[model samples]
Target: MEAKENTTPTPTTTTTNQPELFTASDVARFCQVDLKTIHNWADKGEIRHFRTPGRHLRFRRLDVLDFLRKYGYPIPEVLRLGKPKVVAVDDDPVVLASLRKALSKRFELTTFQDPFDALVAVGSIQPDAMIFDVRMPGLDGVKCLERLRSIDTTSHIRCIVYSDAEEMKKNATEAGAYDFIKKGEAAELRDSLERLMGLERE
Candidate 1:
């Protein structure tokens, strides 16, 4: 499997109001990958900030952190290097853990009992696809999908909706979800995922 994005987000103090004040060394450590990787980050526009009159490139502290998370750089509650490479979001802890257990051996899966955290992590994990419950505490599946689409990096990834509420199926499909598997339809769910993963292969 691919290692944790191979990043190096070095830490540093930023100029109070300046969003761009990172040094080469700061980025090196913030990303936790390597200095060369930092340069590659800048080159890729994954992270960028300012330039001095002498043309010295600088990075923002927040940007560095965002990039670190986006790349799944071994942060809290995240297991980057593993199988399945799947991310599943549901507010119910029992359900979340159960799904993780069922799928962990089959895929590199990560579970988030909170949809909000999953929303934030999506940008980082860049999971090939996602499965989220419809009725979350703060964000419903459709709303969460909206948020996901708003971010350029995670927009194109396939998402599946799993909700007991049949009402969400239309909304999820309209929102461009790959499919909305009514809760308990494990076979249908598996089929949807197989179809999606097949598309990835193509």
Candidate 2:
């Protein structure tokens, strides 16, 4: 009896590359919802998400943009281009110069020494974030923050209060500032910007 030789077949496998991920804020901005809503959607499995080791949730960037388009939410051209527009307000020329140098690489910075001008610019710029000098001569940072909050277009823009006075931190927070940093504290400012822009912290 001749025994038949057995032939083994190789199994075929397909690998899928995942799309780029976006932070909670990115999804919220695209969907025109709060960050909490993004979290809720992820929690309820209403939206596809990726969970990090620390339990942070990330959304598929393409999926989120598509979702926005489906719901008729406008996507900014800059966002599509992967650069965030930022508005910075400082009454000091030196500070403005420093900020321009510090943040130009990561963001499109539109700076104003006058708080009033900054307020006006917000409507046109539609920036992803803002940094305001807490001690501006006329309209202070807290007031600027409040004014921005009252405007429909600028209300959702994340704001950081730049101040040397430790006492003003609470006021800035109360006035809807997203974060606060001491003037000239580059590292703190960087951290805050990263957090606001959804960049991973160093």
Best by TM-score: 2
Off by over 4 Å in 2: 1-81
Q: Give per-residue CA lDDT, model 2, range 77-137, as digits (tens).
A: 4334444556777778788777777776655667776677666656665666788877868
* Model 1: CA > 4 A from native: 1-84, 199-202
Residue 61 displacement (Å), model 1: 31
lDDT of the candidates, in the order given: 0.60, 0.67
Q: Candidate 2 at 110: error in angstroms?
A: 1.1
Q: Local error of candidate 2 at 96, Å?
A: 0.9
Q: TM per model? A: 0.55, 0.61
lDDT for each residue of candidate 1 in 1-202, tens digit (9 for 90 to 100): 2112111221112112322236766767655668777777677877745566796777544344455667766332221222334677766766665665455444556667666666666666666578888787767678767777666666656788888988878888888687888876655666676544421211
Candidate 2 backbone collisions, by pair: none
RMSD of each: 12.5, 19.7
